[model samples]
Target: MTEIWQRPWWFTNSSKPLLQPTWSYLLDNHGSLLHSHLFSALFPAAAYFVICTWFSCLMLIGPSQWRVPRPQILAVGHRSPSERECVVHTLLLSLFFVLPAAVLQSVLRTHIELPSRAPTILELGMGLMASLLLFDTQYFVWHGLHHVCPGLYRSVHAKHHQDHSGLELPISLAHLLPWGLYGGPAYHDKHHKSHKWHLAPYFIHWDRLAGTLAP
Candidate 1:
């Protein structure tokens, strides 16, 4: 097997300067690694958002088995804030979140192993779960804080609760507006109803465990 090595100065000193990333230490940088581009940072993020948005639209709006099972819970044929507003707002906010996320992804993917990666299935699962837990914990805490302070909720969060189905928000920019799952109107509606409950955008148990769960 062939091995590649980066210049010594390319490495940055961290808390553990000797400990390189498992993937980098193992496989080094293969020729197949993605080269980071100044202009291309946001492309991957935008593409991911577009694919997810369109997929949610086709699944929920169009006829498909993936449609919400309890149709009664959903507000059918409902519209709010007009289509133009949704598009404009979504595009604007996408610029805010997508740029940073794309840059981060680009950095992570730039030196990925070509044929063999260090993260095994278990490692990947554990990392994913850790990220989810961290995100959910932060979400749960901030959500509680926002609601507890009337000024905070009224000034910013109020716009989110405007519509039960998140139609008032945009599909792509929900995470930025902090109103995720707006594309999945059915699930997202559950979040807006009865602020005492359904606080998680990903439907995590943070709200319930925090003793904030109420009808």
Candidate 2:
């Protein structure tokens, strides 16, 4: 008698044979070695890049702009994120978006072979341009959504605006829900609050939209 674990879920003593079995049958027979190597490498790299870029930008740019203020080390009776929660949130973001996109890119590259070429300075510039476009799109989509959808604004976006003053608040460290829904509104909130004092716009063409050259 075949072991229950070894047999397919659909297989039974009286069941008819399948004409075309599922892909899982092929995988079970052939094993995962048939999977492309490019997929494995690209996934982790993409995950690392996204997480690092977001965290770095938040820490470096947010602080300099005074969006996130330095917390007083000596302050007492304040509710902050636990170390474990921070790590978990970071991991969740990396796994959900970054890793999946990288995997898809790798799988596409493997399945559809492209011309091999060496990296050049022009390629680097193109990559930078692409990154900027991606950031801008994300920012604009986020901001527009907030303006259009008041329900989303009240639940998630409200946390960002809670900080009235632009200086010295941990804007990035606020709820992760906002980041998931509206990308970079916490940073934008600072720009909105300090429109007069701020120098350059963070992402959106707020000056052009508002019809003011100055920040």
Candidate 3:
């Protein structure tokens, strides 16, 4: 069996995230579409489904004595987010990530040599860690900048902040890089309360480091 890289080739030590033999095979065969759907839609939907179900269960099973307050919104304005919008936006968002990676991989395949072998489990773990690091830094920086920049906040992010009442999976996970286990509503709810919690990639250290952590 071929070993996959710990991270995508580009993010890996190999410096060839795009130029790998496995990717060509993965993308060209029937398996490619399946992989694309899995990455772009199915897997994320699964997370959505699970999180929703979990919360539903909580509402159903949690102690009756425990009362939760109505969610409070920021000064920007308060409005319930649209579920339809979240799902549609999320699907399109997934495509953006999937398509670019595919195109880059295809383009690189013609010019560069393949990786020595698939990344081993350890290597893949390392790659995951590396990906998380990159995503978090970029996520926080991007989110922070948007918060500080009124034009950006008003134009693009305001739409995102509009729906603070419930968990909108697609919109919640629609970050430039938000496919991880952490990219769901529970963690993201903090952002809705105030732009102070839940920086991207689901990691707290960066927020804490930046002193933006509300905890």
Candidate 4:
């Protein structure tokens, strides 16, 4: 039997075709179409629209009690955006940012040499941890700057604050308190209330070190 590392990363020893025949045919013959703006951008944009629309609809029609248990983060006398406004902004994000970025990334990916080796379980775990740490640090700094800089806050980050309700996922995972150094939805809800804190998404180390952890 061939060793695991000898095969491609996506393969098992069985060497089966993971993708559908239609997709494999397109990838073999019309590869550029998969990398085209139609597939890379428009498809993702449409998917985003569907997901956001579905989530919005659920939040609208679902019982309020089904939402995650957390204190409302809106300031006194502050009003949350209406459903229409949320829908508009979500659509705008998909069209302008998500679509363009997807196409750009597809173009760039063709130039990049992707990893072909199957990572060991330990390596996979280590890679995931490294990614989380790097992302947490990057976001911590970026989020802090957005708060301290008035113009940057207004132009870049203020739109994110528009939905201060912090009911994004609306799952009942509230009981799973922010443990394991991971910020649960409740922990993130705290950030919406106290914007200067809980800046990192995956790990709490940066927030603790920067003294930005919520009290």
Regions of model 1 farther than 4 Å from truth: 1-44, 59-61, 64-79, 97-116, 163-188
lDDT tens digits, residue span 9-58, model 4:
45433423343454556667877765564576577678878977876777
TM for candidate 3 is 0.52
Between prediction 1 and prediction 4, the one with superior TM-score is 4
Please identify model 3 stretches exceeding 4 Å from their true place: 1-70, 74-78, 91-112, 164-185
Question: Against the true structure, whose TM-score is highest?
Answer: 4
Runs with alpha carbons beyond 4 Å of true place in candidate 4: 1-32, 43-47, 68-78, 112-137, 167-178
| Cα lDDT, model 3, residue 203 | 68
Report the alpha-carbon TM-score of model 2 versus the true structure: 0.42
- Stretches of candidate 2 off by over 4 Å are 1-84, 97-112, 154-207, 210-214
- Model 1 over residues 1-215: C-alpha lDDT tens digits? 12224323224222223333655654455333333454358666678669657754664466554343322322345434444455555566577666786677666665533434344444555787678668767877787778889999877676445422323223333344343322234544555555676566554366566765443
Worst lDDT window (10 residues) for model 1?
A: 1-10
Best by lDDT: 4
Model 4: colliding residue pairs = none
How do the residues 143-208 of candidate 3 rate in per-residue lDDT, one tens digit apiece?
888888999999777766664333333333334444444444555666777676766647666766
Worst 10 residues of 3 by lDDT: 165-174
> lDDT of each structure?
0.53, 0.48, 0.58, 0.68
Give lDDT: candidate 2, residue 48.
Answer: 83
Clash pairs for candidate 2: 68-169, 69-168, 69-169
